[model samples]
Target chain A: SQTIHQWPATLVQPVGSPLSLECTVEGTSNPNLYWYRQAAGRGLQLLFYSVGIGQISSEVPQNLSASRPQDRQFILSSKKLLLSDSGFYLCAARGGPTGTYNEQFFGPGTRLTVL
Target chain B: AQSVTQLDSHVSVSEGTPVLLRCNYSSSYSPSLFWYVQHPNKGLQLLLKYTSAATLVKGINGFEAEFKKSETSFHLTKPSAHMSDAAEYFCVVSDLWGKLQFGAGTQVVVTP
Candidate 1:
């Protein structure tokens, strides 16, 4: 019965602007959090992942950064956004090991259009 | 390193017909494989997964995939396709640390 929620389902930002996307999971504790981005008609690219609060791993170097401020709250931020930063950003979560391999559950996603 | 390959970039099928989406993968160890579906501008949804327990795995929305070790293939299929099945499907492989590697994705187009 766990669910993931993302804010600002859609956003239009001008170039060189700041970016902030939030993700939170309810009904779960100490879950693994991930941030992924998908370009138009392309697959997902892992941007960052967190195992616990204040612990974040970057999968690829880019204009974005992630922070886990709470056990179930993750945020993706950028001081200045680039045109290339425009894409569909997704947040996913998986429960901690419970004697079985956990499958990731995804949030609705945030669509950012940079103009 | 673990990787996944979705054979077709796009597949077109008629309504009420069989649905087949091919996927192959490579992994250094016994890997966990998954199938996810993405509606337009939506997030990916887990369809099914293979964790070395069952060769054939059934997923939501009447979709199933069979894992072939020799071929390293996990192909998804459905007995009858519906218009609602038109979407993009991805083949995913999990690494040692449980991070997912996604395929380029296959866009399934259902024709009336």
Candidate 2:
């Protein structure tokens, strides 16, 4: 079975503060990773996705960026957080082409509150 | 471009009654569709997916959705509504490249 983990389940930061959220997948290799943000009462917004290490695609232009330094590790970072950056952040991993459906498995998510 | 539209933003249903969450989609090419559920404060969970293999797909928690090509709809249904089923449901469509386009989601409220 494969599982995904995210850290700093809940965070409180001030505007202009640095931010980092980590996500890692277990029992899978070279999976496609994605970062999503959901505003209160809004739909999930795709922020970034990575096909492989050092290959990142930004779906939306925002204050945040994503990086996949290792095959199973993905990181979401911000040099300076903005008040609009407060929301629920999610990390997801999808099986490679050889595996089953292209469905994504998500981590527990991190709730960020910018004051 | 691919897109999904969930018909309802909020639906309240009595327990044991049927549940329906309507969704419509548009895609440039043949599309793959999916329904995902998110409990409060939890990550999104894949309830089911339709990948051009089967039109009717059964998912976890006794939920199922049927894809209608002519209508361009993939509506989720459940025989009996449970209290645990109260959550947010998202309709998703993916183009051939596996990029997903998500709907604004519908909130299901189960009443006792």
Chain A TM-scores of each predicted structure, in the order given, are 0.96, 0.95
Report the poorest 10 consecutive residues by lDDT, candidate 2 chain A: A94-103
B77-97 in candidate 1: lDDT tens per residue? 999999999999999998656
Tell me the deviation in Å of residue A26 in model 1.
Answer: 1.1
Question: What are the per-residue Cα lDDT tens digits for candidate 2 across B43-90?
Answer: 999999998888999999999999999999999999999999999999
How does the DockQ of candidate 1 come out? Answer: 0.58
TM-score of each: 0.97, 0.97
Question: DockQ of candidate 2?
Answer: 0.54
- The superposed Cα distance between candidate 1 and the true structure at residue B54, in angstroms, equals 1.4
